[model samples]
Target: MLGQGLVDVFFEDGLNWEADLLEDTRFVMVETTAYFEAYRHVLKGLQEIEEGQFPFEKYIIACENEVSPPKYLRNRRTVQFDLRPLVDENIVIREDEALRRQRRIVNYQFSAESRCAESVEILNLRSWPRPDQLHLDQSQYEALQTALTKEFVVTQGPPGTGKTYVGLKIVKALLHNASIWNSGHQSPMLIVCYTNHALDQFLEGIDSFFKGNIIRVGGRAGEDMAKHSLKVKKQALRKLQDMRQIAGVRFNCTKSMMEVKLEIERSGAQMEASEREILHEDMLRPFMDNCYDQMTCVELPQQQEIPSMMVEWLGLEQMLGETQVAVQQGREDDNLHDKQEDEIALSKRICNASVRLSTVTTKFVNPTIVLTTMPVHESSLLTSSNTTSVECHGQQ
Candidate 1:
């Protein structure tokens, strides 16, 4: 009643509202949007019901008693009652109008015509391949066979009879025979359960063996499946994109720096051969020795240094030394960046993030298997898909 939007006279914490009896007051029941979302699936399921096909008749109940009954009055007394037409047409038309509006937009995701012919045509279970790994009893095998050969199946048993075990086997069988059911495209499989615990157990089992795209829609999943939730996947995808972009920008900067370095080297090489020789032989010796050993050094050993040309050359060499250090640092940074990039790529591949989604169309864009509860199944966020083929495996 809380999440489904029903009128309640008490607070959520089991407390009743108190009003001043001496003052004028009014009680109001405000409508919320929860009912609309909760009942949207009903609208979709009832799409085939046409006008005048509503199963229930509209009637108004009236109490004809003029005197008030005692607080202790029980079933011992009978009161006069009358059933009449709902003359206030708004009462009846409101629900009808809401349903009409919902019906206009409710597009059915599943249809009977899309079912596989082989699913209904197959009569013998011996025609299907049986894996050596599956160890199922007669009942479990029969249930799995029914699931593989039929469009819909319900496997019911007590707690310890391996209902979920058979469901997992059916999923495995479907994976093995996806081409027959999905027309060569390994489209998504939707598994709807009645509880979060059941959804978690089913998802963990699927994650253990099935290595394709899978996502848990609800937040109450166990820790093992938390990282695979749609919200977490989107966040991880965004972080991956951001890191890649930053790495790209840094790479461009490193490339520009290397280009500038190459230009400097080219300029140094363009000097006349004799001039280069002089700078190498004459200038370098005096500068390294810090003495007037060469004619380029104008003054005494301790007083003045090399010539202005030599001095300028030494300054350029110092600048080049600093640039080399920067280049080395950039290279080191790039190495670290590459390592981080590799780690991210590995994690993405493991999480199926590589094929997961780069944009809105990317998530669930591949052959996906979604495990969720009944409440989440009704949620538009989980059931929304444009994929043409959907294979469902049910267990109860």
Candidate 2:
């Protein structure tokens, strides 16, 4: 019931539950043909049923281990369990030896009859999702190891080194641990990624592992599934704008809680702006003497000496140069050109440059770099009076 993807269903007619010579009325005797050979739980299971007080035989036929013997160890495991009358809690506990049992579990509440086993016709074990363990390419795997050990991690990266991908993996690791989810902890782990695409990748990874457990705030800023990253950017930007309202207001904004509410009240627009500012400032703290590209090692408490580096060349100075160039070329820096000629030319260049940056970031973002789309950063004017409304979903 837990894992439903790969299922191996075997059907045998005339498996009479009532007609049995194997000597147990409680357990409708299953022939050796029904059992899996090569090494057995069902065999040992039969003995356990006779010794144990509970009528496990009734559940034995109904029981399915999510992962089971030979098939899972070698090939994929896809064993489906067919229950006649659904149980109250359909948790199929898997023995460490096997974990391939499964059930589609549509509506488990409609049945309450005691004679549930009388109706089971066949058994199935399945796993539709290929056994592709979250394959993080070399870089991501490395980052994952580092993130697990470090309390605070900052991967100062350029276009790629799997920054977002690596960050998502850390989330995956946290969620994967049962203790973390059950901890009742607050303060949602913050992930201020580089771009819309990077955020999407993070969300996608999160969804793949956590299902629908997370709540994404700030939508209602754009519409266009094809441009999801762009829309997300607009949503955050709009939130940041709302936050700016609190900038000069007399309200108490020094406290973290107070600032959080103020930003939330302003629709989280300023948060996006702040995130952008962080990335802009990612190059270095202004006027500080340290290079952003290099990461140094800290000494271990027990050792007299220190590890040379936790990470080699963690920072990417190239991002600084590229970002500066792009910012210089941005429409934000251009003069207010009233002439039609200058407007047209400026619009063309901005649009072209945005597109180029979007494309460049796409490849980097996939292998997991954060990136903003062309339209998110700048827009071409269809008309001077254009008042376009980008309405993204999931925002009330």
Candidate 3:
């Protein structure tokens, strides 16, 4: 059994005690009954303390048994007991409340009502030309309509049943009426595939109809027409550059004014108050204004412009420059193989950098649609309040 004083000390410093013991020791052991008794004693002590009737001093006496007294009560004023080792061994194992709550929430979120709402009838589609003209059979058209009206709907079919074709049509119809479903800005949607090849094919279909902003995260940007490709490292570097530019303008302006002030203070000359004020107003204000104007006048490139900017920024243009030089040199050299090899190497480097830059700069473009393989769908980049994802899979 645990003394009340020891229980009080445990309540006050249990976390620190556990951490220190765990650092030096792999595990601690205790008797089953004594361990439970200690927990009960601590809880009782806490309740008594809360009720304003705690008997702290009454339980401070050292026991005659081998179990030492608690560390806090070991001073000369009262009974001294070395109870640290005894109590440290008797830690109670309990379920983590927070983790339990999280699991419950996840279970609820994946339930039938949350994953797929009840199917509802949609209005006639004769007024909508593209959806009406889609080559879906009656069942495929009904599935398409159900997806549009329901908050969450899953489409399943065997191979070669026009599943993808009908899904694309539904996406197109949703994109056309996006304003009705969401706020009048962009409609954020995610398309997830089981493989990179499937992701590319899905993006191609989206590109054919949906002309809004699209960002592709993960894997290479295989198609030249892909809107945005995000390469991790180069994108991180670009973000760092953007941060520096934002801070450099204000920092340089402040530093310039400070230098002028220091110069004036160092010049061993007495000046009237009005003259010093005039010097500051004349020297500092215009320079600062000019700096601000210069910074603001520069317009940052739009998302569509990032590919071109990356070509220049990543030195792809320099590789092209070498290619031009190689072409001119080829005219003078009879060894055509050397010219061909040089051109191939340079072209490969340029192409690789182009794909990387396209991948890295994708997030900045605020794409309305994102297509990624299922393995990478859980990436933090894809989770946004405004976005919704659709997962497509096929039997292996």
Q: What are the lDDT figures for the candidates, one per model?
A: 0.54, 0.42, 0.50
Clashing pairs in 1: 357-362
Judged by TM-score, which candidate is best? 1
**TM-score for all predictions?**
0.39, 0.22, 0.30
Model 2 scores worst on lDDT over the 10 consecutive residues at: 122-131
**What is the C-alpha local distance difference test score of candidate 1?**
0.54
Model 3, 39-125: lDDT tens digits are 677677676664335433233333223433323223334221111111122211222336445542111112222111211213333
- Per residue, candidate 1 scores C-alpha lDDT tens digits across 207-324 of 7655566778766888988977899989989999999999999999999999999988865774655464444444345346645445344454464333344544455645655766
State the lDDT at 385 in candidate 3: 56
Give the Å shift of residue 291 in candidate 1: 44
Q: Write the per-residue lDDT of candidate 2 for residues 7-56, one digit (tens) a residue.
A: 34343455654454455323333556533663365456665655446443
lDDT of 1 at 322: 73
